[model samples]
Target: MTGLTHHFLKMNGLGNDFVVLDLRREPLALTDALARAIADRDKGIGCDQLITIEEPRHGGDAFMGIRNQDGGTVEACGNAARCIGRLILDETGKDAVVIETLGGDTVATRADDGNITVDMGAPRLRWDEIPLSEEFQDTRGIELEIGPLGNPIMHSPGVVNVGNPHAVFFVDDADAIDLERSGPMLEHHPLFPERANISVAEVLSPTHLKLRTWERGAGLTRACGTAACAATVAAIRRRKTERRITVSLPGGDLTVEWLPDSENGPGHVLMTGPVMLDYEGDLDPALLSGAAA
Candidate 1:
């Protein structure tokens, strides 16, 4: 593939950055090594996740394949959906777009303020849906804790799955804890068979929260759209907040709303945020071969 150049776009939602490859026109086989090489901060394009846009398989506008910086594939990415949604909307001059993802189908639409709003679908709270290592009668607060059993530093995280599994721990102050030290451990905890996105959320009011996330496969991220969705749902389940709330992350603030489960609605989690197009460029094919610049 040397001497060939692949066009790519660098984009970010809030501050969770990504390298997007629109392979709809021409499909390109992506390998783990190539993904890692492309995500290398110093030697490569550098991003939190690598996104591949493909033709939709389920009657949607497009399909998005997400790979973490470590080159591991995962299901669902909220920010990426909004970014891709905007692309599709602009291309088609439409107000809404449905994006198919491994996790599920998400609906993205243009907001009144020009920001993108993605309907992340309903939260999966069943113990089996979350696929915990053990069965629990109630998933609102699982029986998992960090530190010593007698005096644990963190415990009883409210777990939910918004396309992917997540464990949200409500704290008095999100900045008080050292997430860099705690995120990896919690993400890999035995309670979660598929691992989890770890988050610490501090509720400032019934409608406001401060959050930080240790994303699985990716380390600490400035912003995680799913994490915000999970935290908002978790807080609502615990009666800590209302159905609608604003979650502030290290990168910025996002609006998360859990619709009421009514006869007419199934209660989907809606996430609204901003995405920016940083730049566009082509990848030197030699980079895939680890060649010198």
Candidate 2:
């Protein structure tokens, strides 16, 4: 915790912000407590997640490690991929780079218009893959609900695991529900043993949808790229939308496309969006040592 301070980049994808540390060169022993301190809004750097760039284990360009605000590690983050991709692309002058994560490796390519497009691999639709607590014949709609027994406020969510588990409810109004209240409840529901990201989506048209997500470890998020991907895949499976669509979240819009299964391979989900660099600074020694708060 002593020595030279570590440098970090503050960035966001539609307000789903992160504090990124480059651990590939000068590695730091990042503990859970330190990660929590960095994510604390008042006492620390403050971000939805803490990201680290490390030496790739799978021969990819770099490995992206994600830790939620709660200091728990999880696999996959689409927004983070874009931000990291931009950094790698800028560093190497490459049009694309493969970002390795615990969930899988995603190929991030520079779009013609300057946006970044990440191939988030394929969505996992099986019950066991989603890792539901119990078996279900179909994942298009699962038997789970909230509210009174006879009448529920929300029910039958389309469950899928883009990188992590998510249950997306098709709702009449995306903003009507009290996500701050219901989100935590559904995220911890028994149906999801590993917990889940809860989302309320309203289909605007065949190619557009409005969404709000209660990210699993991060709580209510301004935008969740994986949730957006999950919602689009679920929507397409339900015949509620086309193969490709624009998903608008509280922070901004993300274009998500579900590539259909072709002769070559299975379908993959593509997410394209903007990334922003807010600032760059070194971490305070006190903050890293648990003395800042």
Candidate 3:
């Protein structure tokens, strides 16, 4: 760990916390234990995920590597992208940036509306893409019913992979359910070996929705970027919403467009939102050491 220096930035996208580390020039190596150690709030600088910006690979403007609090790597993180985009822009003084993540290449544009628009790319709805345990001819809606909620009430979920596996439960009341209590169960449900982000969403209109989430690996979060994108896709599939919709999460509202590629539709879903800088600091060895100890 010699010659190690970690400059960190604290930021949030609707309260989905992140510890931003600039590794583009420093090239820090990350391990799960190290990630956990640094994410310890009481003993270390806490965050929901650790985001490292490194040299781009395969012809993207920038590259972002995301690790969950439990020390697992995940494909997409909406809030972090905006924050990282701003960070990169501040450093490079550019308005738009293309970065690579484990899932795929995503485009982020710093809009004048004070919102950053991230091209989340087209959603993958095939059974294998959602990567369900088995095959489903039509992935628009699959079956999984939790009793009491009714065997048929919540039976079918419109599944999709918006960079990460997601199962959306379109409910009538986004607030009626106890997300904090139910989120952990659904997130780790056997159906998704990779685990999944659980969303309880209520459609306010064809172009509007309200959502609350229990994010896989991160538990109940104020906002989940992929979840919003997935929900929008699901809503469109069910004919509940149009291609472009306003998804309101606990953190705030995100403008999500499905990008159908039709003459009147979009080719890439655009997620427009904001990232706020809460603070800035560096990780001290003492903090990580204490967490590990």
Per-candidate TM-scores read 0.97, 0.97, 0.92
Best by TM-score: 2
Q: Which number leads on lDDT?
A: 2
Taken over the whole model, the C-alpha lDDT of each candidate is 0.90, 0.93, 0.82
* lDDT (Cα, tens digit) per residue for candidate 2, span 1-293: 55447899999999999999999877888888889989999999999999999999978999999999999999999999999999998987887899999999999998866789999998998999998999999999999988899899999999999889999999999899999999999999999999999999999999999999999899999999999999999999999999989999999999999999999888999999999999999998878666423
In what order do the candidates fall by TM-score, top score first?
A: 2, 1, 3
Model 1 C-alpha lDDT per residue in residues 204-264, reported as the tens digit of each score: 9999999999999999999999999999999999999999999999999999999999897
Q: List the residue pairs that clash in candidate 1.
A: none
Candidate with more favorable, higher TM-score: 2 or 3: 2
Off by over 4 Å in 1: 291-293
Error of 3 at 165 (Å): 0.6
Tens digits of lDDT, candidate 3, 1-293? 53345788889998888998878776666778888877777766889998999889997778999988888999988888878877777777776788789888888887867778888887888887877887888877787765575443455777889889998888888898877777787788877878888887899999999988888787888888989999998998889999888999888888898876767554667898888999987778665554445
